[model samples]
Target: MTKPTPLSGFPELLPAQRIAELAVIDHLRRTFELHGFASIETRIVETLDRLAKGGEIDKEIYVLRRLHADDDSSDSGLALHFDLTVPFARYVLENSGRLEFPFRRYQIQKAWRGERPQEGRFREFTQADVDIVARDELGLHYDVEVARVMAEALADLPLPPMTLQTNSRRLIEGFYRGLGVADPHLVISIMDKLDKAAAEVISRRLVDEAGLDDEQALLCLRLAEIRTRDTSFVEQVRALGVEHELLETGLTELAAVIDGCADVSSDRFRVEANLRIARGLDYYTGTVFEIYMEGHESLGSVGGGGRYDA
Candidate 1:
């Protein structure tokens, strides 16, 4: 008899868990549609160049090739969609004229990643996303409202408490530029790894590898550790002797988001200044968000997204 084979990283949920997951999905879909987001879907395969835009996502992509593609000419390195955002961006660009401005849409689909997956992190998993993209620019208030709605949808889930750690890329970039940092992207990339790497290791790498001085590297590390529920985090960052127009602007927008969601009784939503939440995608140009489980902080972000004004 042939032996049975088990797939690696791909998970199978128990009957009870599947029921719970379905209930969660159904609730989220209804909430999203209620907010006027229409539904859409994109094809599974995308070209290699589009998938490899930022270099970081390349590692996670699961490349595909035709069965008869034996030569380099046929080896285009198409890949399974790693996340919903990239495909959505391509969809918007392709269907620009036919689509309405400030397009609001919801996409729920399975995404594949070549990751060493664990319980929550899987090789193939479902992502339920709701986003609003404008032809020109989206207002900051809209950004806050999306976060508010998402929080409400997940409030009843039987999971650990989660907080939306929000920050603005414009704010961080401005601060870095004002500090005379020549390569802000490089700095942001390094800072994004703070959660995975230790403070000492990060500081050393920034100083020795990225050419930042000890003081600057230390300051960046300290900023990564600073998190809060409101604009209070801004005062803490200011006390560190770092003040810049971009940082202040980010703080102001974050304050508006906190105030807008003030009616939400759950403390699960907060504004954290030290949130070094660079989504690592080149498209996101404004406010970035990260959802963290309260007790399982080390498991990394469970959900995240940001505004892409390009």
Candidate 2:
């Protein structure tokens, strides 16, 4: 008999590791429920079209197919979900009639992404997400509310200290538009690489690819460099000499979330307004977040999410 090769991305925990994982999950489940978030589980697979709504994510999706299936099998269109939000949105649409207003749901499930597996990221991994869906309008307070819940959850965990770095899509877009950039989204896409690429590389991309002049590129870099633990970031951005109604709205909203989370956040789990955290996803309309733990900064964000008003 041949010895089986261990899969690189799919993790198999030993008994002790499994127990530890279960304990962590249980703690998160309890924390979420205590905050009035009901637990729910979504199906593992969604149609490729539905999952492909975010174009960039399509490359990271694992398509589902049956063994020895026909060339044109109907199952070929299905794929394992890359994240919980897309499925949750689909669930809301399908079950809208049965759900109550301002639905608070906490989903803990295994999500699959086909991206290269690295520390803190996996091809198959358990993800815990808390989201509040409303029928019409959702107050900005819910943004702060969800952050508080996650902060408390992480603070209670037995892991290293964590920081919840946050930013606003409106803020980034408004800043770019105020700078008179022809395409704000294009600039955003380039700015999102600040964490991975060096400042010089990003500056070159902004000028060559995004068609930004040297001055505009320099300002964009300045905006991305803003990081603060309090609302003082408002003045920092204002000092840049850009003004837009949406920029003011994003500044106010981002400040509110920072201040709101500050009250509940612990020393172990801190919150900061990090402008470089422009989530690549197009759906996120308002606030965005990226969670990082001490001593594991190189692994990139262990967790993140944002408000999708659409």
Candidate 3:
């Protein structure tokens, strides 16, 4: 008989808010389909083992439990999916025999995560993802294509100007290797916090946790500071004197993506190379992306995705 209590992380949009969101989703759908991306929906729940394949999000996964069910129930190993990309990968594997090579698919669905909710982040939220997957190999050109499609979709919407910040895992990993860092992945995990933490704090963590020497930590910080709208970033990284074949490959690939997206970029949308964007997930390889609205920078990334090994 008490009044209903509102949950903090579960957001409920009002009629007006929902109308606006639907319109945006619709526009995204049209844009995606126009780009030859077919629509698909994945199950909300996946086996914990399969979900854990994504990365270090085991703590944030929402386990599925059934009331009045026995301990031996088949649901014991199930949990709600944290992100669409993980599930999409599973889908591709399960249906690989029927799907075409370099299959482009778009999925807009609710995903659940048990993280603290603040600003743009929520425990339960709807996400739209567009991914292109292949059987044996995937071309790099699809990377540029997807970025342009998303940028065009956002431009037609009534949102503020957007910037798609990009980085390369090959670049980060190779750079760390060149520095003789013992654990490049661990360093990346710590460096990903550059946006949320101060330079001094990250530098200390890099030295303490990632086991980097003082000089190496300083160099890592220097690498993280490089950002550019064009291929100018290439010189900045080379100036640091780190050399590795993977680093060179990443530099060329990332530069191509930025240059390729240049034609579609305008006052509304732009793509830039930001070396500090170490997207926290170990599965991400090659090019990584993070989209941000100009005035809402503090809300964290509005949208983000990255390439993974097939």
TM-score of every prediction relative to native? 0.86, 0.92, 0.90
Per-model root-mean-square deviation over C-alphas: 3.2, 2.2, 2.4
Residue 33, model 3: Cα distance from true site in angstroms: 0.5
Write one digit per residue (lDDT tens) for candidate 1, span 1-310. Answer: 7996668878778999999889988888888888888889899888888888667567888888778766856568788999898899899999999999888899999899998856667898899988888877688889877887788777767777777778778767766766667787888888887777888888888887778888888777776667776667667777777767887887677667766766763755443534577787467787888888888887878788888765
> What residue pairs are clashing in model 3?
none
Candidate 1, lDDT over the whole model: 0.79
Which candidate number maximizes TM-score?
2
What candidate 2 gets wrong by more than 4 Å, as runs, is: 1-3, 66-76, 115-121
Q: List the lowest-lDDT window of 10 residues for candidate 2.
A: 67-76
Best by lDDT: 2
Candidate 2 residue-wise lDDT at 130? 92
Q: State each candidate's clash count.
A: 0, 0, 0
Runs in model 3 lying further than 4 Å from the true structure:
1-5, 52-56, 65-76, 115-120
lDDT of 2 by residue, 146-222 (tens): 89998989998999999999999999999999999999998998888887889999999999998999999999999
Cα-lDDT of candidate 3: 0.89
